[model samples]
Target: MTVAVTLLLASLVVGLATGLLFRVWALALASPLVAVVSAIALQSAGFEFFAGVSVIVGCLVVSQLAYLLATFHLHREKHSMEDEVDGLPGKHRQKNIRDQYE
Candidate 1:
């Protein structure tokens, strides 16, 4: 139980970070690599074949969902910031997003 929870948490964190900080290609490459690594680790931990497969599947699914959720949040945030900039008064309005920060 503890191991399962830890695996899920670790996968979620990794997915969220990668989604936010890396490109889609990198995340695509990472999923299979993580699966392979986790499989070996689970084998050494003495998990049954089916149990290990299930855990691997759960980790991958949870991680991918987390990545999708994080990306959606970033997309929404960007749009909201753009909308805020559009609301700025004409004389004070800036063309670029960086201006919004200043």
Candidate 2:
């Protein structure tokens, strides 16, 4: 029970930290953090830390890959829309509207 809760908390923290890091650094950092946390969890649980670390690293890799994939997909969609619209069409027209409150 304690192990399960710890693992859950660790995973959330790792995910959030990695996500923030991804915004600035590179996504690859998540794997190492996941591995280290997994090792600690395994040690506390009386299991082989290496194997647990490997599994956690795999999951982190998958998560980062998914994040990258989704980001690219969203970016592409945004650009496609931008290409269709070109830019704001009536900027000068809107600017010409006189303010009545002078």
Candidate 3:
């Protein structure tokens, strides 16, 4: 694979791991930094403009998607655990504030 593609994938994987394994907002910011560094490296390595841009965009998109999915999974797990702890027969717990209000 090209350097651009390799960097993009690497950045994405790191971003996903950050989002999934850590809940800290500051830690999640590393993905964008990685993307920027990869894009710069690609440009320095004589990559075409389109290739560099593609890698940058791909990195951002993948990182966002990973973050969203990870957060969603974490939230779902949290709510499920809460429900289990409630142990209310014939009753279900609401997962969010909106649900509780409604």
In terms of lDDT, which candidate is strongest?
Answer: 1
lDDT of 3 at 90: 24
Each candidate's TM vs. the true structure? Answer: 0.71, 0.44, 0.61
Q: Using alpha carbons, what is the TM-score of model 3?
A: 0.61
Off by over 4 Å in 1: 78-102
Alpha carbon deviation, residue 97, candidate 2 (Å): 21
Q: Highest TM-score, which number?
A: 1
The CA lDDT at 8 in model 2 is 49
TM-score (C-alpha) between model 1 and the true structure: 0.71
User: Per-prediction count of colliding residue pairs?
Assistant: 0, 0, 0
Tens-digit lDDT track of model 3 for 1-102: 377677767766776677788875844477668777887888788879887788788877776677677777777745565456655422343345447688
lDDT of 3 at 71: 71
Clashing pairs in 2: none
Relative to the unseen true structure, what is the C-alpha lDDT of residue 92 in candidate 2, on a scale of 0 to 100? Answer: 45
CA lDDT for candidate 1: 0.79
Shift in Å, residue 14, candidate 1 = 1.0
Output the better candidate (1/2) by TM-score: 1
lDDT of each: 0.79, 0.57, 0.70
Residue 12, candidate 1: Cα error in Å is 0.5
Higher-scoring candidate on lDDT, 2 or 3? 3
